[model samples]
Target: MRFSKSLIILALGVSLAACSDSDNNDVEVKPPVVVTPTSYEFTVTITNLTAAQPFSPVALIAHTEGMLWQIGNSASEALERMAEGGDNSQLLTVDFATHAQSAESPLPPGEQLTLTLTTEQLESLKISLATMLVNTNDAFTGLNAIDVSSLAVNESLSRHSHAYDAGTETNSEAHGTIPGPADSGEGFNESRDDINSVAMHPGVVSQDDGLRSSVLTSQHKFDNPVAQIIITRTQ
Candidate 1:
């Protein structure tokens, strides 16, 4: 009977040892996890350089490398809409543009306006800015598809924006065709009036300069480099 008791005790000891070893072998192991952060932001300040020509609400876009208006290519319908009427809604809704904003109101000559934008990545960020020359037909000014990916935080850059003639309208300087206060005429007519491709603007010749039909005065005449834009990366 004592031998039987000893045998039972031995069996229990073996079972307990097996359970402890199994428990140790069943332990779980896991690796650390990592995540990447996203986002880039910046600001643009625009200063009008013309004597009297007010700029329409400026449209600024941060896109993933795409042209808004090529110098020799035809302007898109969205560009045509904004270029003719100073309306930026359609331009901001373009497919390639990831972020966009428009200035609050007309930027008068000699005045300054600023805007801000953000995007998920900055490696290939391209910027496009545009505004109508309120005193001329189809005349617009601003930079197009400028690469800003290399700009570092708090770094700054500045460039003069030359005027461009949106080939959508004629430079007739006619009374009823002007959209600004000088004439209070129409904006964004569907008809294609001028050359169907983009080109540098030819300065306006106002009524004071013997263009009797032109509603603008000597104050509205302008030359190249109509405005200056400054960009500063904030993030």
Candidate 2:
């Protein structure tokens, strides 16, 4: 999440280069050196939108193409680790990633965290982000393979993301199965004991929602659009 001042200035130069105007009277003008940044500075702002579910530190990556998690596909081990526990180390180190960044701490309910990522060129311009809903079992939010090429300098794009189930683990909601501050239990078991495909997370059914043995309560329940993510071309 650190960028040098020189890199920041160079990014600003690229933005300025993108805005040149040519007059009709000009006989011939050379195109600006499209300093297609071998690297670019991207700013990501994540806001936890849940009322009570705090989010784990966000993981952001830039890749060529391909989603981090596909709806009908099984969750990757890296994703499973993050969804199950709050650890983003494996996800940040996924092989296909061209560049990556991670937040230093969790984003509490209604809190926000901003991070900067730099990647070389549009070849790695696809953006992916993920973070766990700390109150649930294997639930996470954010987008995958979002095209950022068209984003103009200083412009931004924002989205509200829903929770997704890694499906590698069951939604038992038992006393010690759930991770996060609510349970402080174990994370990332090697078992594929649940429905092994990614899907929109069915909101947790806490003790208040009829799951008697559940350690969670009504305060931990959540619905769609759990987090707000904003990306700016802040070279």
Q: Residue 196 of candidate 2: its Cα lDDT?
A: 98
Model 2 scores worst on lDDT over the 10 consecutive residues at 19-28
Writing each residue's lDDT as its tens digit, candidate 2 over 1-235 gives 3568889998988876665433445555777888654657889999888988988888999888768899999999899999998789998999988888999988999889899988767543789999998788899998988899878779999998989999988899988887888898877788988999999999999999899999999999888889988999876
TM-score of 1: 0.85
What stretches of model 1 exceed 4 Å from their correct place?
1-36
Cα lDDT, model 2, residue 192: 84
Say which candidate scores most in TM-score. 1
TM-score list, all predictions:
0.85, 0.83
Candidate 1 structure lDDT: 0.88
- Compare the candidates by lDDT and give the number of the best one: 1
User: Model 1 Cα displacement at 175 (Å)?
Assistant: 0.8
